[model samples]
Target: MRHALILLSISATSLFLMSATPLQSQTEDAQSIRMNQVGYFPNGPKRAIFSSIHKSDTQKHFRLIDATGKKEVFRGILTKPEYWKSADEWAAIADFSQFTQAGLYVIEVQGGVLSAPFQIHNHIYEYALNASVRTFYYQRASISLDANHAGPFSRKAGHLNKSIPYHKDLGKAQNARTASPGGWYDAGDFGKYIVNAGVTTSLLLMTHERFGSIFPDGSLNLPESGNGTSDLLDEIRYELEWFKTMQDADGGVFFKVTPLKFAGKVMPADDPSLQHMIGKSTSSTLNFAAVMAYAARLYGDVDQSFAQQCLQQAEAAWQWALKNTSIRYTQGTKSSNYKDVQTGGYGDQHFEDEFLWAKTALFLATKDSKYSISIDDLPEKYSAPTWAQVSALALYSIILNEESFAKKVSEKAKVMVQQASVKILKEVMAHPYRINQMNYIWGSNIVPLNAILTLSFANHIEAHPVYLTTSVELMDYTFGKNPTGYSFVTGFGTKSPLHPHHRIMMADGIEPPIPGFLVGGPNRGRQDANSLKRYGGYPSQAPAKSYRDHTASYASNEVAINWNASLVIALSFLEHQRALSIHEPK
Candidate 1:
């Protein structure tokens, strides 16, 4: 592959201790500093957010204090605080990128404010990257988890899904059953949805394909950790195998395996809701075709027989999508929480992107123009990939595997990625937090990461250093560098989300939520109850500040595989960039 990146071997990363939620000892000081809570890289960019300081015009200074707070190894002047409209807060930035030493340290402001400790190292993000990837293992549906692998989060497998019946719309007998099993739960709920899985699964597979060295075998501590195969692939194969069952005899893929409504906050084994096929759509079928083709190419060497099977499945799905091209995911059962909207409905009426993606992926797998889309057929605009809109996924596939694509198609793909990258780069530069706008809707956290992913792809399309540097800043925004000043990830920071809106963490009797899961961050819309049950009101109505750390605040603090997949790949790509900066010495 022409786009094959230089492989970087990884060392074992040290464990990050789980700090007490809202660390009582440093609660007041913690608010004074905002940065990547995990740490900064020794040679990478180092910046932090400082607020509510400055005794005199000339005294706006911050010091890098050792973990003991007794020694000041470095000092830097704070930039003037800039007013950010979204959160209506003044934030000052301190740049200390010149400090290339590796150590644990904190920041000290003028008014006796201090930050929680963080590290500076070459492999600063390796552990978080591994954790983000391992979160998939925790989400596996079917089979029990042993303590050796799952540790404190071990649980008996639920959602056996051996005999899920089809809904009446499928025109099957009332007693007919199809067994679809062994994929991660889609979100905080117990639904196994294909429409959402389309973007999530493909991204994971792409990450593994591009950066295979970072996720070496046994790195993720999966059940198949040491099976002499990439643990990430082992995990992805489980989902792919489940995807195999999702395809009907005629090749259409079912939209989701879900009950009429979502389950309550109960353990997976105890969720009483019935699991069955909701429906199928053109979008889902095309998505299935694209991923199957992608899997066939990536897994060809790992499992020749399985790769051939996937290629066949991809062909069948392409034929099905050709016939059923306009099917939207309009059929959804009733849910108590949702009234008119389709519960768990990945409402997408647009199938052009889906069509292009399926064609591009099949082309990559087969190198056949019959399965390829012409550059003239592309949409005029390109956007960052979401489950609903994945035109970029197709373009990215063409861009990454340029050798397998026609020069015109490859150039067009690069132009599309760069077009989207320009918009995101402009926004990243304009925002005070070094992000795009606070798209603080449901799953708003993934917005910046989607930008990060696009920027990375654009970097691949045209190797510009600024593309990747901007991408890292967006990643920093997700961790703890944003207006919220909270690491949205469940367990990697000094003050992380303690109670994400995940049913398993709530019902599993665990005092701490599992590590590596990125919670849905702040949403301006307080659509969920303000003070539901044990949860309190959101801190503020400000779009950037409207977040609660309560399990009941599903509007803001929820976990989903789709969102986590973005986080995993962003971390992996950033780590790859860091590795290149080290080993390549360019």
Candidate 2:
């Protein structure tokens, strides 16, 4: 454990840089300190990075000051100023990992420089997991969010969808309607897309599966609090039950349920618009199949009938996908005469990933050799999972289980994960902030969470102290230890997003954005500048610094179900790890 801690510290000499497109900057504005604003576990690794544009402003020492006590608790000499000038002007670590007192404190340098205050309690991350999980309940459609459940964010039920009509593109009359009701609003808007739901539900289910002990019955205080199931599963079942409605008679799944255009800042209850059953695609069917098959395995003992139904539906969807092998979702625009907008689409021409995922899940659920794919077909590159690509998720499931596949296939899966970890570890060491992904894209925050989720899975495949510490360090980057210095999630941390690009929070008259939501962080793409009229510009063009906490900055600020699912998984996994190791020293 001590060796793992040493390797993770910023004191490590060798550093690497992946392919990154840095936004060239010469303006003098880089004097800041960064650390996890949400706080840290008492026994876990603690680190802070300080940056300055004044290449000459060399402060040799740093101090840890208690915010409440207003006294120096510890002090240490800063590392030699190195040229980490790509993202940071000057950088060094204030690693007070040994000062394990439970209190509120900040890292200080040069007498006045201080980082955001953070707590040092054992249960520092408890509310993060609970609040993130509860946000799903808040995202539920058709159910009124009463004061008892939603607190100040309460609202009248909206998008009940008692009659959802098929869109003109669905080979039906424009007026046909179906009673497909009640799931999550997929992202910032009210529409719920099956493709998005598939990944979101899968990750949430995986979280509950591995960390089931953390979320007990009635833990979340949902309406289904005492219903003999964990509140986490109860919330997930709401999505699963809705998944039952999206399936066609022939076992196919609809791509999405959304309006043609977006509603302009209208509250859910007041937004009078129609949602249509959008086109169906191969990707959606396969995603549904994979999630359902995976879920069936987990829920068998708790809900036998539902589990059986899920497995049957999963097989049927897989068959439908096989028959209609090439359909893609080139459907309606989220553009707004009709209203409620959903999230993005799956890949237009790639169903290979989908096939691999669906096949793997079915193989696991049924233990049937026929559902297995060949080891030769395994993806050469294991990228971080997105809605469009989930082969990595399939590989993770395979690697997590002991001898779940043919020897060659299982060995290949483990190698792929292990290879990815080595690459990720290099990125973690090379980046000044110790982040894995340096080139920011849309929903950039999801990359690290997914990567850490991958690392957590890697640890299960082959136990390594480095994997655990890598997960913890990258998790630190998520909470606020990076260049952005924002917790990236709403309602946690000393500094967090106040205005995310979410319609509910925008129209609900709430002063703060919805709690537990993780915004699309620091997208250098700046797609919002073109999409919104008179857009609020991004703070910087740098890949890691190009974020704005404005409701109009959808490129960087929109909250999504998939992103929330990843955050919940990463945070809860660490929380589970903390519980395991805290007792070792106590």
Candidate 3:
């Protein structure tokens, strides 16, 4: 693959730290600095800042030190202190974009604060992107990961279902195991869920749609790299193939395929539990409908027959959803034999979001008037595209599409985009870390990530520098610069989370968790039992201060397919922007 050379060169010499290095003990006046561990591209937008917990004015200069941690690489002057009224803290900004030399460097504050070393290069994030995408490959089930094909992460085939049994509601089960072979594990658990797949697949497709030039054929170094399609599309199709098998003859899709109980901490091949295909809810069916419809369009040029099949399945699911609109896949009632509280339920009471999303996809795919009416009628206020909330996704697809839309639908999209942009800007200004209250729930890191999508859409509608800057601040808070003083992404920063709640990382004896796996960031809710048992005693209820880096802190430490998909979208957007900068006339 074209990107492999760049990735290998950087990662070949990288050290896999077994644990996080402790931050230097803070003096009363010490200032804490934070930035992404991989640093910025030499020609890209670059900014980092120092946080002062005391809210005291830090009238000090900072320096960038070379790899030796002794030689000064660049000197930096501090900007005027900005008071954050919400957290009662002060932050000072630093911009060293003028220092364009490609090398490893660390930020050093005057009073004993030293940042983790980072690099500035043309392809610094190529490796991060590769590692992030490879996680999906690592999660592929029912396929033998040959050493020659999978490299160091090779494994035997798992979950090879020769036949599948339909739930009692659907019909009698198939006697022979139907092959639902390859798709990602939804999260830490070994479940393949359609609801989560809907968001994850769309984000990956968005990368190809928006940044197709970046990923040439053979760019991702996957086993299918040499295939006619782009590596990104190939990886997405690998999962889509499995998704095709998830639909019943009736056209409705199952919620997930998983064991009767959550598997223990074990390797994919070693988890010897029988997999069950369960749940046929409107939410899952509509989500399946949306993804399949959009994917049909994506696959049209590559494989027309498969594209037609996807559209057919999508239309089928849409029809099934209309007949059974109100059925929610409650955890315990979805399956008769297994009332799963152990695995992800992905259940939602509201179907309007799913309805609008499926309608948008159908409208775009076929230009059907029936679908357009519903698209125009979609509620103005809807949740961002979370696992349970996906109305924003429909808006994104509508806004990004070049096809003509009804005046009502177009006006609705613009209104939604502007309202979301304003909400994010207002909240970011109110908070010290620039993260909003919307991100204070479980898997909070994804909120800012989802906002980036919204901001990107808003940027497309009208070029707003504040929207882009706010997006950057969101990146800073996510990568580092938060109250926890740790980079939420594993294997990137000096002070990154080492113990994420990922089963393979925990049980596989990996030194650090998988590179580029973004941990669920600060969550004040602390809803998971694991998190409550470990960190609930902490007195601080401030949103940013509620995170812990332990593997048991599922609320704040678990990694998910949908979250990483969001990261991929953000990273690809930055990469695209960096490309634009590089090509600009001097």
Candidate 4:
């Protein structure tokens, strides 16, 4: 037992010596002092440490501590790309080495009357060889030690330019100038007109319900004019009034019209040469009325009597369309009306079937059984109709409160929605040169059609993967790329500009105008001296090409409006579905 005690004592002494050795060595080692520390703004022209400390609620403060124990602080601000060009600056600081403890240090910042603190820590390298490799690697990448020779560290600096002065006097001059009004403008640019009106009305209605305001100025700003909320509403009101003026005594709208002149023209009626054209058929007339029904509802609160009159006119238009179904003419083997020749037989007819969309909208407004019958009869004509046509039928079914019918159509539509992803891919491959513009056969039309179809099928069927994918692609293509700029130059080539009248006109005081008035000249075959010069003295002078030049000839204004409106509606529905999904029982 005595021998065991002696061995235990020796072991205890050795353990105590080992434990106390590090503590004694830590105090005896020469202390590394920090010196000549500096700080500056990020990317700034100058490099100076004006103060020892800086502070801000939103900004992060950085510091460099030297071997002599002196420290400098840096104040930085974050900014976006647009702001970076005009505002923010950068700064470089001296080396820091004295604060190399393996623990966090809280450094205080003095902001005149305020103060703040930030914590920083020192990292140790377990493998010096790896550390040397990392240092060499960074050096090879054009990053190395500064004048202080303490660090080869890289940091991203985000700062706002506080030095640049702001001026309010130049605000008026800074406003974007309006383009010249000439060349081809929308005579009856129906699609865009309707789509704009529909989106405007829907947004106004939705916002009014939430905020008790007729227009939400904070949210809706005009892209071109940069107009405020009130200005947008006034613009919408002006357009509605213009549309009202274009209404015929029979309650039907003309196929096309010039909004500025308030002159209405029925294509075949006004131009005898176009009487044989398939686009001039009465089905287009019915579609116009259907659009009018929704417009009437939107403007109803403002003019109830006029709104009621529009609904009645829509009913009459539907009746007229049904009666004129048999009026057939010839454009080659393809019948001008009644029969489907494009897809062979009427098994997948959608050309004139689009008229059913108006029928559905009108039925929703009036709840007429005839509209319901017209919609139900669609399946009898086509063995398996397209999602676009069936979606329209489903919408009508929903209006009739026929849940079963809606479910049936919605199921079919859901499958088509899945097909949309593959369909879009095919569309891209089919038209490689101008996938966004020239390939109207399946490009622009399919996108919006798919959106509306998906919306119709939303609750009745499972959400289609293509619904989300195609919608995003369409929005990106339309609002981001195509509409802004990327349109085809028509009239100069064999292909006539799609609905030449719908393009916004811009005058350059040049003659022998180009197709789109917004970017080129009048393009009405009138050659002037200025136009010749603008065309670079080419033997055949033509106008410049812009994306806004393309228009849907079938019903330009209505189609555009409907497409955009459908997008708005679909988005709203999707949001509502998401909310429901979140709140649903787990």
Taking every candidate in turn, the Cα RMSD to the unseen true structure, in Å, is: 4.9, 8.0, 4.1, 27.1
lDDT of every model, 2 decimals = 0.80, 0.77, 0.73, 0.30
* C-alpha TM-scores of all predictions: 0.92, 0.90, 0.87, 0.38
Mark the regions of model 4 whose C-alpha exceeds 4 Å error after superposition: 1-240, 250-253, 258-281, 296-303, 326-355, 374-376, 379-461, 464-466, 478-505, 508-586
Error of 2 at 370 (Å): 1.9
lDDT of 2 by residue, 1-586 (tens): 2212322221121111001112111122222677876777776677788776345655568888776667899998766555553353567777777787887776677655655566787776676777788889889998898766666678998888898888766676556789788899988888888888888998888888788888888777788877889888899999998898999889999987777666668888888778778778898899999999988999998999999999999999999998999987763354221123343545458988889989988989998878976877689888777888888878878876747677888888888888888889888877766778566889888888888888887887877777877787787877788777788878766567998888999898979666688988987777777655466466566677878888888888999899999999998888888766642121
Candidate 1, residue 456: Cα displacement in angstroms equals: 1.7
Q: Candidate order by TM-score, highest to lowest? A: 1, 2, 3, 4
Better of 2 and 4 by TM-score: 2
List pairs with backbone clashes in candidate 1: none
Candidate 3 residue pairs that clash: 162-177, 162-178, 163-176, 163-177, 163-178, 164-178
Cα lDDT tens digits, model 4, 1-586, are 2222322433342243223222212211111111101111111111111122222223433343221233333333311111111102121122122232322121222232111111122111111111211111111111222312212122111111112111111122343221111111122321112212332343323222222242234322222123433323333443444444333444433332212112233221122111101122243445445555665655566567867876766666666656655332222244433232121121222335546556656755666665553324343332112322433432433432444344555444344444443455455323211122232231143344344334334433445433433332332222112211221222111112333332221111222222211112112232233433443432222221111232222222112232322333343333333322111111
**Better-scoring candidate (lDDT), 1 or 3:** 1
Model 3, span 1-586: residue lDDT tens: 3434534543452442212223333443322666665666675445676775344555578887765446787887777677654333567776676777777766777765777666677776666666677677777877887655455456777677655554454455455344566788888888899999998998888778877676766776678877788888888988899889888788888888877678888887788787877777898899889988988988899999999999999999999999998987766655564455456787689888888888888888888878874344667684677778888788777777735586667778877888888898898766645566554778878888888777878878887666665676577666666666676776665578888888777787767566778888777777665545645443346766677777677777889989999988887776666554432112
The candidate maximizing lDDT is: 1
User: Which segments of candidate 1 are over 4 A away from where they belong?
Assistant: 1-25, 53-59, 332-342, 530-534, 582-586
Q: Clash number for every model? A: 0, 5, 6, 45
Instruction: Put the candidates in lDDT order, highest first.
Output: 1, 2, 3, 4
Off by over 4 Å in 3: 1-7, 10-31, 41-45, 64-103, 164-179, 333-341, 436-438, 528-542, 582-586
